[model samples]
Target chain A: MITFMQISKRYGTIRAVDDVSLVVQPGELLALVGPNGAGKTTLLRLLLGLIAPSGGTASVAGYDVQHNGAAARRQLGYLPQRAVLYGNLSVAENLAFLAALHALPLQRVADVIALMQLDAVAQRPARTLSGGTAQRLGLAQALLADPPALVLDEPTVSLDPQSVASFKQLLRTLQGRGKTILLSSHILGDVQELADRVAILHAGRLIAIDSIPALAQRCSLPEQIHVVLAAVSGDEPELLARAGAEAHLDGDTLQVQVPLARKPAVIQALLHAGLPIRDLRSSSPSLEAIFMHLVGQAQH
Target chain B: MFRHTIIIARRELTEAVRSRWVLLCGGLFALLALALAFVGMRSVGLNGVAGFSRTAIALLNLVLYLVPLLALLLSISSMAAEREEGALEVLLAQPIARRTVVFGKWMGLAAALAIALCGGFGSAGLVIAVAGGDTSAGDYLLLVVRSFGLGLAFISLGLWLACSSSSRLRALTWGLLLWFSSVLLYDLLVVGATALFGGSALMTMLGLLLMANPVDLVRVAALIQLGGADSFGLTAQALIGFLRGLRGSALLVLALLAWIIVPLFGAVRAFGRRDFTA
Candidate 1:
């Protein structure tokens, strides 16, 4: 488990992380999302004990980050946004160095190397690696110790879609093994798919934190229902309106919007209206939209 | 702590070897040693190769000029580049103390420099011995060891500068200015100060100033040990009796050691206190 209790990091008058308090329970994946200067990296650094918090405390696996930093760090694995590893060392050498640092056996290096599918270019210098290969090496290093908790900041940024998929699969595997992960990213789709909880930070403060469904419900955001019809019916608009939905018709297809709770009633109404409905599709407000709505509110 | 430090140091040593830093510095030291020997021999009406004493004295000046600068640049560049390139942050995030990182770098770089100096001098010595350049190996080894000591002292200073500076460019700039001050500016300042003060005040100030720089400390030690004290300046010559004894030799050794330890301690403190954010 990882916990931050009222952590604050100040630089002169600017507060980078302002009185933030949160926890990632064991076997939970918490996604931290924010704008450019939203303190995501600062909070990660504070947790790693790379920088002391201006106030409060951070702990990893019950060890205080400040007082028991080495022990705390031993329980944690970190993958920075752009993990510029040792450029002169080969891929295997870089992994081996980190492995030696954590006192792990040499077999662990080969394991992570194979886990990340980095066997082909293990002997190549890190500086010559492609973006995807280098980031994989970074992940390999992070996984070398097989720590109980992992903190990955923008790990998938700048990666190709295939690599991102590969990375997420590996993360899923680790998650399955009960690793507590705090992932920071701008990619809300991944967070929506993977996170047990999403923490939205803005202007150095967490404006919102909850599961996507809970957040959407709390915000009372609308969901879209795309209705495909076999033939245009003049009464379709009136029927949707009568069913208390805000809808528009283009040809035989009707696009409808309603409160998430009202979705079932709209579908029932459409079926009962005797219209030749070819298909019906519903999309809830995306995490991105929820983020924007919340951040916009916080901004105001 | 020892394991972590050793691991880091070993990696640093590997980097040095792979980057050809060891070879580069080694080759430079060897070429310069031979070149100085040849130059010293021709400076007189003599040719072939100079004697051990003559070559040792010439090499002492070379050590002061080259070793410190190389050590400073090598160490500062390594530390600052790690910071800029995000290696330090990743390494620090591991379960290691900040001092371990600093000390590891120091030890590893120290070993690399020692190997370079040894290889350089050993190869040059082999060449010299085969050609009947000089018969005495003791003086040659002493010069090599002193040059390594000088390099260590400057390496510590460079690590301190790297830790204290906010950026790589700033660190490099500071390292260069420090090298300039240590090598050229300090001596000129002392001379100007001596001329301005003149008399008893100048004598004490000059004596203190001689001990203040590692370069000058090694220089005075070289002058005394190589029997050039009487032939050198009166200021240094005045200390002939005091510095020539066993106690003075021990004091000078301790002083050189202080040059290594003090700055290294500063580096550890600075690194621990500062943020390793990229």
Candidate 2:
């Protein structure tokens, strides 16, 4: 539903987005993860046609963003990072204006307001709402037109935990409805929980793009083996350490970071040690670890 | 495209109305018009100044000083504030063209200012008519309409400045300087120039100079219509002689229309070309 083809945006000497190409297929929930100055926002703005690309092209629903910006944007529901609304207008009024801009029926405003659960303060001025409420209002406006594609830039940045959970739930529902979503976020947990695929951008370039497990496999990060012993044993941590694992003893629990290929051998070694095992669990590398490993590798 | 533009325009208008900008500006104009009309009537001993032409002429000076300045400040501040508050970015992300955004804002603001001008001066004109005064309703209506044109010209200039400026502070600085040059300093500079260099070229230079400033163009247009050109001293008489009668008025109207079109076009162009990243 969305594609960025060799897109590059430059500000004099600074290349904000450098020859990046990405695509979000129909009903695919793609999360864009990067640190600050990673050009995630720039990439999204390029697709929105808010800023022209220095090179290459971007398209939404097969319409070139530069030449057919209005048509391209018609297929997109954008939630900006700041999500600022007109302070003087009420929540409902703001959404209604957006609906009118999209040429949607006024009924969409009411529907979105209800969907975002903004009924409690629908008539209140946007400026008076809390950060979470305002974020919800921003989401409501984006969802007002019922566009098939969504571009959400850090949609949950300012939300409380409860609101973030609800927002994630909303994203899941939208995904269930077959909306192609491209969301840029700093929260790896949210991305891990919702995204079907993750695109890692580092220093204006997309370094990696794949599913979490695939990325982990490609990065070859170590998996963590956690063992809770029934009793603490002297020299047990030493024995695990000698087996080429980064082993640490925390009270009665033994935690070891080992390569994925050596997990079976490590488990056999721990079993032959004759330690009473209260609990044994082997966990794959987390998305955060994979992200850090990827970004760290790119830095080197 | 037209629908999107109108929708954005309607939003701008609704925001102005909800924020009481319309009421505030309307009330201010009405109060000033009433006060000026009553004062002019008293000064003319209730005889000559009771007519609509005379009151409109009296209000003309006020409009020249107030309308352009108010329009510049209002339009510039609104644009600057929207841009600073990031509301403009939100609007631009919509499925609308950049030109539509600029034109919509201009139309909405122009409409609001028109309502205020009519309500304010229109009510004052009605008061003079109700009091059995010798009022030329047509002439009075013409004055109000021209004042609206003047407002639109300034609004367009203001939007041009707002669109080009990088920040609210910069927009305000440029707006104030433009307002000062056109409203307060343009006449002084013209008078000084004509006095220092008195020749056949002076009339042509003066005509071009007047056209350069929409405020002066509006003032000259309104004064000539009110038949008060002679009161503005030798320059007005000289201008009237050089350009002839009807042609001069038409030229001033044309100049005013250009003032509205050229700057608005520049604004639309600037808005369409600039990046909204910041």
List runs of model 1 lying over 4 Å from the truth. A250-252, B197-200, B233-235
DockQ of each: 0.80, 0.77
The recovered share of true contacts, given per candidate in order, is 0.82, 0.82
Model 2, residue B216: distance off in Å is 1.1
Top candidate when judged by lDDT against the true structure: 1
DockQ of 2: 0.77
At residue A146, what lDDT does model 1 achieve?
Answer: 87
Give the alpha carbon lDDT tens digit for every residue of B1-278 in model 1.
98888988999999999999999999998998888778887899787877666778888877899999999988998899888888888998899988999989999999999999999988888877776546787788888889889999999999999999998789889988988998999989887876787666767787678778999888888878787778756654555566788987888898999998999999999988998775
Q: Tens digits of per-residue lDDT for model 1 on A206-280?
A: 898998989998889999898898998577777889888999898778989899888889889988888888898
